[model samples]
Target: MNRVDRLHSPFEQHSRALAWLAVFGLLLAATNLRGGLVVFAPLVLEIREALSLSASAFGMLTTLPLICFAVISILVPLMTRFFSSITLVVFGLLIISLGVVLRLVASYPVVILGTLLLGSAIALLNVLIPVLVKVFFPSRMGLMTGLYSIMLSLGAGMGLYLAVPMLEYFGHWHYPVMVWALLPLLTCLIWLPLLKLRGEVKPVTGARVTLWKSATAWAVTLYMGLQSFYFYAIVTWLPNILIESGLNPLEAGSTTAMISLASIPFNLFIPIFATKMHNQRSLVVLISLLSFSGLTGLWWAPQLAPMLWAALIGMGAGGALSLSLSFFILRTGDGVQATALSAMAQSLGYLLAATGPVTLALMHDISGHWLTALMLLMLLQIFQFAFGWKAAAAVQIKPDINTHSSKRTP
Candidate 1:
């Protein structure tokens, strides 16, 4: 066929339109993934006071979602047998909307119940979105991953930034928390069109690959875990830390939002840059250094340079997360393997991350200082460096699978 004829082909036009639609759906969905977990942080003080929650109880608001991610992610791969990825994502968004509404109830137990629901729904979305990226943009994994990562980071920043203001405007914390439910509902509307294309983008099926046997997969898992630990720990407590350092609740919340927002640039570009490199070991080293310096500054003189510390931590954590998500695709040979690795890495990794908020809270309660927690967080950078170096190698995790029985993701 001539070039002009090929360009005018109906198949080519349809494919381009479908690609844009898929990308739009993915980006919108990404915005809902983290905002629910993050929006609660800035309003912690008001909620705790109203609910009479202890530190551990207050911590549950954030930790519950991570716990759900750890547990629910393992089952997502199996869910593919019954539902397409698009259906699962749409279901998750609806559930997330319900969870958000449930959380707005004035009762504490009801709040916890809502949080559990929300977390469970987010867990499903988390495991499958990358699978969608792998399925839809196999040749451009880095660019697509970066786009979604940026959306996640943007969601988090907006949640943190808007929560306090919403609280002020609504004259209550519940309303501020409840407002986030709209996002998932709106995203669900965006995603509904993809359901029609379900046959074209089914999930990986057949015999499951054993990613646990791969050392590189384990390294990626650990890298994901440590990076998550750092990010969640900061998200949960940074506002309180700033408060302790003499910032008012508003200032603390805004500063915390700054940390989440600062990561945007790294999230936008890191994956793209990493994909062009032979390996990402140097990037990992750079991540560790930035995090170390930020933590040190926070520990020593937070009041003097809170925004600077926030930016450094944001950049480090953002780059590390974008890279880790890329690793699920980069280190794996195909969609089936990417799904398996994502399941393993996120399940085990988030289980480890789930401990960060409560652990930091306990460390503070026991020592009556944030320094102990800060020290523990700083020490984690060393492990991040080690695992990231291993995970960043130009190595693909080759899982043993029965090719004849196994189904490739669309």
Candidate 2:
């Protein structure tokens, strides 16, 4: 049997109602990953004015969480050794809740500290969610992945579209940030019941897979990094680009939300679509072109056709992000290996991504034109396409099957 066949033991049967409940729990957890990340961008100008932040300082606010993702990712796989995955996820949710509440303190240091806490918290789930699919839903990987990606995109959209109204009602940025805490709180209430689940695998004690030696793993990592770099950088600056191109603040904000909305359907569609094929090179090629077209359009004529460009990037980014998440399982042997590969990709991947916001800001600051930055983003899409295609190859990672089989409980 193939490595994929070996690592993916069938999920132990559960009641239909219980399976749906697990799906509910997965979707709930996925929602929090990108919700808070979107809150800051809409409030960027307000945050800068209120806090008296310099350009680079504001950039750091954007960069900090990604740095946290990188730093925290290094420890998550190891963390699974000591804690059950469900327990670790519960801890992550609480940390996210704490971080959200922390942002309400109205002090710079405290707010920064809160942001760090939640970013670190989200970082843990980032590694785990894909693993969840591998461990528990190997039979439903693509559907679950797309569903998870859609939930995250919706979270981002909620954070974006809801911010203005939230500002109107709450009368301050801090309150909206405070409102985000409710998502984790809600997810925790739902997830808490699952901790009592019987027959789940306990943490295994053994040597971990050495992923650094694998080319497909590195392909997954770079694909994750470059796609994140583009998505975060574009989301951060696209509003400003639209505003400069003659859109009003409201329109620019709306356009930004639309980009995320566009991605939603694509995110839902891509993984399921990609799974029907042997390799996803064609999907990668399509995304690269869509990305190139949309980004270049924004650079050259954003004012002339804002919705068109936004939709292009939206679809492109959505498919790309879903594909990247899909690779966590596609390239690895099982949920355990998925967690390890996730750690490597996201730890290093996010560090690479960490530079996107700050680096783009610095580039724009130096050049005084969006052209240079947009051009660079377009160029990177090609590079991203390379990694995406290779990572989608027919060959899978050659894991230590003998050791892993002995260690994992059936």
Candidate 3:
């Protein structure tokens, strides 16, 4: 795709009102994505005992959303065939609201069903945001990314902090879970105007196309997956890990909150910083070392330097999250291919992430300690470093070379 094809307008930019609405809606929608998932971290132990579930079973609950992301990703290309990304986001918000309500039923089956629904809902937004950014904020991808990503970080941080308080005030877990339903509902109202602004036009020339010819695409995908692998694994188990090391539930939750907070600055600034640089390989290397040291410190001295280790992990891992999203646009030529690459990366990445919780939980079960599990996380950082080297290369993922397969993506 040339400059004209890559930069084609998805919506007219003459209306200041519509532009503001899109920005507002985009940030609000981002805030909702991780709230549904983060709510489980602070309450995992209470939830485990309440449900009478085994470690393995609880792991499944945490992993269900990622599993949903993986499964639903294959359908994204198909879903876009009928609906614009703006319209798709509205539908996602509705499904998330419905799923939040379903979670209040308190039955095991009902809760699992709700999780599946919400996970699938988040999957749509996760895969669609890059495409929408390409359409609406092409010239300001980094700044816009930082804005939405900070919201993601804040939502996640605040979610962990609010979980216990909400539980205390509501006197039950179900009510707190249902409160998030309002976010998406309000977001829907804000997003509805976007469809009118888009004028129902769609881009089809680059539809269903992928960057299979370039090795950078695979590198970006692997980096995305490996970072997610460590992140989800840590979030699901870190509180418990701290508790096992002698902290109370409050302290454990505090550490989790601190970790989330630490990542916020990085999430808000990494994209903008990256866009101004030659390559992000050095940033990746710096964060990897920080994460490696943090994980080591946690394993060796959980009580000592808890805040420092958490911050390091946050900058390393949380920073990785922003970088991964930035790479989607940075490494791709245009919005159309960015969508294709984002869909491919997130689909497989989250699927790869679905294993994090279970794998760590199982490792603990077999070894009777978190050492084996922590070591596994440490090893993943090395892999992330290797892949980030190529992904952060100064090249775009165009179809420069051919790599054939029996099947095609459409």
| Candidate that would win on lDDT | 1
lDDT of 2 by residue, 1-410 (tens): 01122233322444545555667888989989988876887788778888887777776666788889999997887787767787888889999999888766657788789889989999999998778766766767778889999998888778877887888888888777766888888888877876755247456456366678788999989999999899888987998888877899989978887778889888987888777778888888888888889998998889988999999998898989898888887877655687788899999989988788778889989999788999999999889988988998977787655545424521
Q: Best candidate per TM-score, number?
A: 2
Give the clashing pairs for model 3.
none
Error of 2 at 289 (Å): 1.6
Query: If both were scored by lDDT, which would come out higher, candidate 1 or candidate 3?
Result: 1
Better of 2 and 3 by TM-score: 2
The lDDT per prediction is 0.83, 0.81, 0.79
The whole-model C-alpha lDDT of candidate 1 against the native structure comes to 0.83
lDDT for model 2 comes to 0.81
Q: Which pairs of residues collide in candidate 1?
A: none
Alpha-carbon shift of residue 121 in model 3 (angstroms): 1.0
lDDT of 3 by residue, 100-150 (tens): 887666577887898899999999898887567656767777777888788
What lDDT score goes with residue 108 in model 1?
A: 87
The TM-score obtained by model 1 is 0.89
